[model samples]
Target: MKCLPSSLLILAVFPLVVVAKRRRVPFMNCPSTKSSSGLGMVKQARSRIECSVICLNNPECLSASYCKSSDGYTCQLSQMFLAGGCSGLPANGDCTQTFVVYPCENGGTFFHENRTCHCVDGFIGDYCHRRYRDCQETPLGNVLYTIQPFRSDYTFQWKCGPFTSPYTRVSEYASVFNFNYTLTWEQMKQGITPHPGFYFTGPETLHQLTKQGVYDLFIRMIVLGKNSGYVIYKHFRVDSEAEGYACHWKSFTRYYEVPYNSDEYLDGLGALGDSTKSMKGARFGTFDNDVSECAGTHNFAWWYNPLGCTLVTFDPDGLNWPTNRTGTVEIEKIDHTLIGLRNVYWYVEDDLIL
Candidate 1:
């Protein structure tokens, strides 16, 4: 038999693996409720499912109200959400019904009976758009909105896992962050490109630094199928705009320390920082754009270093924890991360961990 090339042989041995897209049921039936808002596009639909299909086709359509009239059935698409309680539908019973169309964020469960979203542990708000941190403060606009603030220190947890390629399409392996900010999938589709790793937007990160005084930054990273982990518990201060959303810290304290002396170990995050390597200035990188160098090669975004040695990452292959510093062994992969940030002056503990 003719010999096949090594590359072809390898391909034959292991067939190409394909990832399937996730199925999304975007709407749920609310038989007892109808939209209180004005009518939108009125169309003829055979059934409520057809009305849902019509609403699904229109990206701007938030909900669809189907009414049974003497002539026939009419499908009315509206941008207003189908909230709970009666909508004054003339008490016609099942003659009129509404379908709420939207995905709840952060692994929230939508209850069709009341049109309410029961959010995950760390998130709250109507659509679970806001973090539980919002419960800490009372807004100026409303007095009734005032809630009992958390009296003592608290912690919130969010878990991120590995996801396969293509990243743009929603999959079973995709990570849920917030509202439309679902990591890996929705972000790529919405023109936001980043690896399926934990990250905070530049604006959000900057907002946290706006509070004056020292802040305690705590990061806990656990390897999958392992008992041990790494933790960065220290105090830091941010010099806003000093770098591309990168800040400075007082000490590099961690549960597991790097080798005592190793030339390969440049800094905490390799050559990402400025010339001084004090983390004074650094820029983030994405797969499309290599602002920090080598980010494109990894097919992920981060404060990368051309020289390697990554301190923290949610990427399975990108978590280089510095065993390579002394040429002992390769850095292990990190699969889970929990981050907490708190201002020294303020008594609140904010969970900015993605």
Candidate 2:
């Protein structure tokens, strides 16, 4: 035997080298676990890539099966290649479906069993490159109250939560009533104005009071995105005449400067200017004079006096009297307290009302 030429020897060695190099095929099915007639044996690998690396490094490994494990992945090195077909190995209860590991583009994971790429949370699209916002319920502001003489109202503002967008359709219902009457569900539905309920299109919204009464308000928000929105409820009370003052005269009096039966008096014993009196009336015994002096002497005095036949005269000097009659009348003032709200109810949807 004689040695071959250098060029021919190099060509022969190149084919052998090519045959020894490992081939990687994505989504190829293989035995998920170690079996007698399937993959020869199982060895631990840190990840799916490590499993493929294990097969590439082994001269006898014609194919590989990668299954997720607590430590990482279990690499089943097979001596046979099924060419993207299912393995005939007995199914292992603890093993995941087997397939060839491939690179997942854009921070995604290629699921060997499913042969699909799965993006992490907050990401979407074919390559997991697009960021997506999750839908959420908007938060409601504090309820504000407005009072009137015969009615009152309330208001609130709200907007979509973080990474969420408002939907077109929104619904609201309120159950309003007082101690004397209750606003029925049908009445509430009738109160919803402008058709199709409180549908809104915006990132933020303000809910104004259309009706006046003490009631509970329920708002249901529908949002579209990665998540569904939520329903919120609030209670409010409005009252008229919740505060004011009540007043009346305690005591009043009138006085005369001239003597009784004086000729200078026009309509009475004294001129109107010369006479002084309380707007209301004087207290008993506030003035001086005898009861007999007033009897039949003056008809106005006889009928107008609180004492009647026992009438008393005005102060003689017009400066002092039996009682302090120069002071202003004292009044008793008070504030009105609000009444407790009764029979409160909240309805999220029309059918929920009762």
Encode model 1's per-residue lDDT on 319-353: one tens digit a residue: 43433334554455544444445445544432211
TM-score of 1: 0.35
Model 2 over residues 1-354: C-alpha lDDT tens digits?
011111110001001122221221333224344332255779997655555556655655645666655776687776664434455755654443333333344567644332345665444433343332111211222211111111113322222232222321223211111121122223332122222222121111111221222233222211212111221122432111111110113221222323221121111111121234221222111113212334224321111223332222222111100111134221111111111111132222111000
What global local distance difference test value does model 2 have?
0.29
Candidate 2 TM-score over all chains jointly: 0.18
lDDT of 1 at 128: 52
Candidate 1 lowest-lDDT run of ten: 5-14
Scored against the true structure, residue 226 in model 1 reaches a CA lDDT of 48
Residue pairs in clash, model 2: 135-227, 252-281, 252-282, 253-277, 253-278, 254-277, 254-278, 255-276
TM-score of each: 0.35, 0.18
lDDT scores in order: 0.41, 0.29
**Positional deviation of residue 186's Cα in model 2 after best superposition, in angstroms:** 88
Which portions of model 2 miss their true places by more than 4 Å?
A: 1-39, 68-72, 96-354
